[model samples]
Target: MITVTLDALDLSALLCSRVCHDVISPVGAIVNGLEVLEDENDAGMRDFAIDLIRKSARQASARLQFARIAFGAAGSVGATIDLADAEGVARGLFGDEKTKLTWSAPRALFPKNKVKLLLNLVIIAVTAIPRGGVIDVAVTGEAEAPVFVLTCKGSHARIPAHVEALMAGTPESGTVDAHGVQPYYAGLVARAAGMQVGFAIDGDTVTIRAEPAAV
Candidate 1:
């Protein structure tokens, strides 16, 4: 497998840029809504502004929560994160998206990095089905050495070529920017956890599987 590495500072900057990119729209919408609330005289317009503010606030919160786990130091090294919590954040992140999440992982606690990898994979899976679809997540085997299988089903579902290249650690993926950083980070997480991630596309379904790295 090809290996990819980046300076710690660069990785952090790219991830931060990505997180900002995800939440900026909603945050900006919230501000716009507030402005409308302040300036609009029509009662109907005021009600619309309030509704927009509420929804945008929720979206921003969800993205932040997901980023906290997926790209942040959620806890002390070696700490464990509950799968149930992971499911909650995953659902939250999917709340406003066309894609839906169906999680089947156990409710037990697993290593922080494992949970991080799962969340990152969820992000990648949802992207496979941009036209709105269902992503079914299943985890099997022991908690410490579990396998993750995410099946994404939707019309015209397909993994992006850049994402594929980044996941494979190929030089052809080019510079790691905000758009490509997440997949690269996901690959890093997998390797850090002593696991390998693979992807396959079958018709309208894309399956992402991760398991113990071959010795």
Candidate 2:
């Protein structure tokens, strides 16, 4: 296995880049819509531009909210986050995506990091099915020791090799960048929470499972 390491500063920088990348497209769309409003005199075009602005603004907000929880510190150390709130941000993030999220986690509080890991896994699962699909998220066990399972089913669903390597902390190359830091960060979160994350592929389905680390 190839061990890849990054300093805290580097990790933070890469994660910031990832979050910015997620929201930039929608923000750019909003800018384009504003430009249309400013330069165009056609009422029909102005109406379309207004609609585009609204949708893009909402998309940007949703991506920011999701990143705030998934990639931010979220709260003071040792704080707990409500699963319901996690669900809300998750649904928001998936709103404009081709994929759909079906969350079945309990409406209880879990450690903030654990919830962050769950959300990060949601992102990984989405990538597995780029052509769009259903991500069924389920949590088992108690709040203090929950197990997160995400089943992603879609046509041509497959986990990228680099993603698998990053999540396993054994990247093929010893370099981590914005494009691959999220899964690396997810691995860090799991380690911090004393959990183990695993991924399995079976035909067109990808399963991501996280549970307590083995003794």
RMSD of 2: 1.0
Model 1 lDDT tens row, 46-124:
9999999999999999999989999999899898999999999899987766787888978899888888999999999
Off by over 4 Å in 1: 1-3
Q: What's the true lDDT of residue 196 in model 1?
A: 89
Clashing pairs in 1: none
Could you estimate the TM-score for every candidate?
A: 0.96, 0.97
Worst lDDT run of 10 residues, candidate 2, spans: 160-169
Those runs of model 2 whose alpha carbons end farther than 4 Å from true positions after fitting are: none
Model 2 residue-pair collision total: 0
Whole-model Cα lDDT of every candidate shown, in order: 0.89, 0.91
In model 2, the Cα lDDT at residue 149 comes to: 96
